[model samples]
Target: MDPCNRFRMFLVPFVMGIAFIFADVSQALALRCTALSGDDRYSILYTVQAMHQAKIQRQGALITVFEIGGGDPALNGALLYIRIEHNDQAFVWKTGLNVHSIQQLSTGPENTLDIRAKEDFLDSNNMVISREVSYKIHFYLNNDTLEDAIFVENSPKIN
Candidate 1:
């Protein structure tokens, strides 16, 4: 084989290999969220409960994550810049500005946020929800302050 042709052939495969690796990595980035529901209200406005420690994990992986959430009732928009901090971690996670459009909390339930496990919670695009892990959720009632953070425990209901 000519030296120039051989070099070209190697380069093509090298680039193709790199591209394939990236494609596989990207495929791991997926969000698997469960449906949540609850009917709670706030004094000033009103609040509803969503999923509890809902785990969004990679199909065959594990991730360190905490479910933090917030939404505005007055503006009827997802309240961003709200505070969300972990008990063991010092860094705080700011709530995203995306919410469902509906007037008043529904009698039924709905999915709040699509929980996806990721390598870094600080980066949205790096998430890959793990389906093997379970999530825990906390609930709370809002009056006029943001100090109230309610956490609920999920257990097998006894009929």
Candidate 2:
């Protein structure tokens, strides 16, 4: 066969193989979080206690926070998220929230008085990076209703 034909065959298969590989990797990273609610602190704290039971849950760096201020105004519910760790350092993707669930989050040593998601800790990210991951909205109680909607979102990529 001509050199042109040989190049076409090799390139086509190589490109297709790469596409397939990426598709599979993305699918594997997909995850889901179940929603739970409670009027008092015990119920809310119980949910977190159950989530952190595993030994090597995400298997990278562990990023955790307990916020006690008004939940960020942009978002309504509380949240927990996981992200891909970068170079064995802080996480790269979602930070502490690459994958997380939220709704009026309350936390306290998994035993002390529960703290709301709006608490200063949860509403903001640590100051290690030049650009900060900001919480658009956070509030302990919604003016309209206590009911909150769980949202699915993708994390921003950093190069």
Best by lDDT: 2
lDDT of 1 by residue, 1-159 (tens): 999999999999788667645643543443222212232111212332332232222111111222223533322233212222232212112232223221121111221222322111111343332222111223221342222232212222112
Q: Find the 10 residues in a row with the least total lDDT in model 2.
A: 110-119
For residue 24, give model 1's deviation from the true position in Å. 0.7
Model 1 stretches with alpha carbons more than 4 Å out: 30-159
Task: Quote the positional error of residue 50 for candidate 1 in Å.
Answer: 30
- Model 1 lDDT, residue 49, Cα: 30
TM-score per candidate, chains pooled: 0.22, 0.22
**Model 2 root mean square deviation, Cα atoms:** 17.4
Model 1 Cα shift for residue 102 (angstroms): 28
lDDT by residue for model 2 (1-159), tens: 999999999999788667645643442343333323243323334434213211123222232332222223333223343221222432211212321222222222311112122111221232221222222212112332222222222322212
